[model samples]
Target: MHPARRSAGWMQTRFFVMKKKLLSLILTGLGILVLPNAALGAEPKTIGELVTKISNALYSAMSGIVLIAWIVIAFLYLTAWGSPEKLKTAHHAVIWAAVGTAILVLYKSIEPIIKNALGV
Candidate 1:
């Protein structure tokens, strides 16, 4: 019946609601990304085709992850405001995201070489 206890309970309830919403949003995003590919794509007949399909799926997933990472980094930077430690953490996130993006680009650039090696 105390005001402090009521406020605490309200905060906990709000936290749970936010967590559930975030989880559902993530699941929906994943379904949107994965379901179409799984349901619409034709079955691969050759080893090369199978490898290519798997590689493409991985590339798509990684690209989505990188996009989400960048969004998180931006949120970190915004929330950091003028705090030195938070800003440092945000900078680190930015660096890591950049590294991930570079890796993705490198993988994409080498796709032709991979196909050639597989003689696809």
Candidate 2:
């Protein structure tokens, strides 16, 4: 009826769509990452085992995602057509992705020491 009310309804619909898309993307990524372990028959029978399996799967998935993000950032930077906003976004993406990858690598490297200490 009113223009302002109509615009607000449209904005709400757009927000819902974006939220749904993000949720689907996350679910698909998790399914893709977990399918390999499922096919390999790494079924967890206990809560601790499930936690470890999920942790390992998440690390592996994050490693792949970080690598892909770096590649995407590189492409973004190269094909930015001299756009300042695009370059800035790409730069930020690269910095955050690199930091995430480094943290994951550090955790993996120290995982053995942690396991030894815990005697798991």
Candidate 3:
């Protein structure tokens, strides 16, 4: 096989392996967050309650993710060591993380309005 083609095949394999590992890590994290609630918490008796529970879980997960993002961005900023490119990348990450946090805040703010509107 051509060396170029062989290298491309190896890259693809590595990419797939990385994706698989990421997926498993995500699943494990979610299970750790969710399984205890499922096993120990009482079941929702109404649809509204169920929806509330799901939304609460989603909010918790998103908040955790945002916190992690901020930590990662902080690390990036600290390690940039005055390199322009690394600083730029860290700045971009900060902006994205801020946007994510804003969205979460909006969701939290509007959730009460929504629940009141729906009488849930």
Candidate 4:
């Protein structure tokens, strides 16, 4: 009877752990994909015709920035692992990332450029 009770407890613990892990993954993915969009004035909707709805100009630009950043990060990560050639690719990614970051910073300082380029 004691052994059966122990087995039951172990199963319950394993179930709880799995549930926690699944929830964590879901929340993390949501944070990466949706948080910045919301923060930047973009709303994500599954029911709508379009995927994302942009509310304001600044918000839209921010969402664009967020998207670009994530893509760059993904690219950098994709090349960061494995052989020497990949490492060199990662190094170039890092350099491009630095340039991108500089551009982003300049963009913040100079809104007129984006406004003019966007024709807004």
**Candidate 1 worst ten-residue window by lDDT:** 31-40
TM-score, each model?
0.74, 0.55, 0.63, 0.35
Q: For candidate 2, lDDT tens digit of each residue in 9-116?
A: 897688668667865776687678767866766677765566567667778777667766775676678657699999999989988988988898886666556556
Identify the runs in model 4 with alpha carbons over 4 angstroms from their true place.
Answer: 1-82, 112-120
Residue pairs with clashing backbones, model 3? none
Off by over 4 Å in 2: 1-33, 42-52
Evaluate model 2: give its lDDT: 0.73
* Candidate 2 local Cα displacement, residue 19, angstroms: 18
Q: Write the residue-wise lDDT of candidate 3 on 1-120 in tens digits.
A: 899999878977886786678657765775677665566578899767776777777787787688768866876786676999999999999999999999998876766676777887
Candidate 4 per-residue lDDT over residues 6-120, each given as its tens digit: 9878976886686678557655654566555556653444322122233233444544555555555565565355668767776776677677667665655455554455655
RMSD of each: 4.0, 7.9, 6.8, 12.1
lDDT of 1 by residue, 76-103 (tens): 7866759999999999999999999999
For candidate 3, the TM-score is 0.63
Ranking by TM-score: 1, 3, 2, 4
> CA lDDT of each candidate?
0.80, 0.73, 0.77, 0.57
> Clashing residue pairs, candidate 2?
none
